[model samples]
Target: MTETVQRPTLEAVAARAGVSRATVSRVVNGGDGVREPLVERVRRAVEELGYVPNQAARSLVTKRHDAIAVVVAEPETRVFADPFFALQLRGISKELTAHDNQLVLLLTEGRDDHARVGRYLAGGHVDGALVFSLHLDDPLPGLIQRAGVPTVFGGRPGWSDGTSGVVYVDSDNRGGAREAVRHLVGLGRTRIAHITGALDQTSAVDRLDGFRDVMADVDPRLIAEGDFTPAGGERAMRELLDRCPGLDAVFAANDLTAAGALRVLREHGRRVPEDVAVVGFDDMLPVAEQTDPPLTTVRQDIEEMGRLMARLLLRGLDRLHPDEGHDPAVGAPASVVTPTTLVRRASA
Candidate 1:
């Protein structure tokens, strides 16, 4: 019979490093007070033995699974196809990897999926949760909170206000939209139509509000809501064109929607920036070159929001509160607020 090689364990690592189990635990858990030489010795012995700490065992002591779940509240196709979701996902994945924590992604299916997700989180599958793509009357926030899980939202959480302890991360939607509209106004376009995102979503509502705020004082006949999808944008564009054929400018809530508007502009024989200027929010999935006159849009650092969520989740894993993670308030609340800027392209 051939001899069998043994796998490494904490005990083996401690013995090899000439330390007790307690000392080994401290070093492995990154507890303080261990001497440098000893730390190096334990690390080297770990390498030689090819020892890997058992995350399950570590959780017994740390009370954390070292995992965080990012929840997207959109249909599978939208989650899979949307460029903005991909960008957010990339940012979250990178941050979680850097912190040595596992990332769990969950998509809400419906009522049944919602119940299952609530039960799973309460069962301690992850340390915290980040949710996104909220509809107007979503009850998931209340359900998740009652499940005893620390949670955050990609944008504003829908539901009743005073969500006691929930944290969220979002961009400056209203300000960004307003700035884009203001730019169009300055360009001498008064009959401007808007391709707004879903009215229920705060991002859409806020952006639409910004447009209305300006147009209320200028022209209120140029507002229409899109479903934040290319098809929706196309449909909304058609509706707006039907009602206001004389529209000279358009602002879409997101880049894809903006691109849809661009197609309609071409079909209508309206020249961009000459007969009908177009602008979009969320500078993700750069398609400026793809547009007939290239697309000018508002840019938000969505990737940064993902990174911040990961860091916050990591902090939660370590028994740190989201607000306690940074020493100074980093212009970002525990509810991170990333900035948005106007990116001018040929479309506008």
Candidate 2:
């Protein structure tokens, strides 16, 4: 018969640290009121004894799971198809791990999943939530609000009514788009056209606004709607070419779309940066660097943005539980917009 190895208990750790069991529990649970010298002693004892706090028992005492729900609302195909979401998730996971919190990923494909997500959040399964890929008319905003869970949006949400008090993180989509369009204009490309992502998304809307800000008098025919996919980029590129054959430049919404547009442009016998200079958003490595001539695009710190989202949500959670020693006055900002820079490559 195999012998069982015993797990260290709180009492064992307390005795080793020369403190009471209650003191060991306090230090293990964030060391709120515990002094520095004692906290260090308990920590050393925990390390020496290989003590792991019973999460279920701690939750029973503190009413916190130390778990964060990351809700991604998009098609299942898009989740795996695009590298953008994956990069962001990596950042979120890294930050959450650093804080000793659990990450519960909630993927919602459509309206049917919203109710399930809402119920799960309301059921007190997690401390807070980090939601992403919000559309203009997405039902998630309302459902999340009703659930009363502390939430941090991954991007700027569309609705202003219910989101007045909500916190969010986003890149400077409008500013990045403006810089791309301006760069094209500087190259003496007057007939510049834009392929937009789904207008329902705030990032797409902001980028389109930036385009218009740079070229206020641009003809409406110069704009084409894309679904932020390669196939959508192909169709949009075809439409733009058919509508405005004289277009000398194109600004694609994302790297994937830009890659698709580049292929279409090549098929149409257009010489990039000579006949039709191109620019894309999201300096996604897989698509941008691997493009035929490489891609010149707007670079946003996508991973950093994800990390910030988790940090902000965790800060909110800390505020919710003041007993954990987090300062209520140092709450998360209402909105955080990461800067975007223009990355020059052979394509542009």
Q: What lDDT would candidate 2 get against the real structure? A: 0.90
Give the alpha carbon lDDT tens digit for every residue of 201-319 in model 2: 89999999999999999999999999888899999999999999999999999998999999999999999989999999999888899998799999999899999899888877663
lDDT for model 1, on a 0 to 1 scale? 0.80
lDDT of each: 0.80, 0.90
State the displacement of the C-alpha of residue 62, model 1, in Å, after optimal TM-score superposition: 2.4
Candidate 2 C-alpha error for residue 328, in Å: 10
| Candidate 2 off by > 4 Å | 1-6, 12-19, 27-49, 161-163, 319-332
- Per-residue lDDT of 293 in model 2: 79
Number of colliding residue pairs in each model: 0, 0
Once model 2 is optimally superposed onto the true structure by TM-score, how far is the C-alpha of residue 130 displaced, in angstroms?
0.4
Candidate 1 lDDT over residue span 242-316, tens digit each: 989989999998888888888887898888889988998877655655766778899888788888777765665
- Per-model TM against the reference: 0.88, 0.88
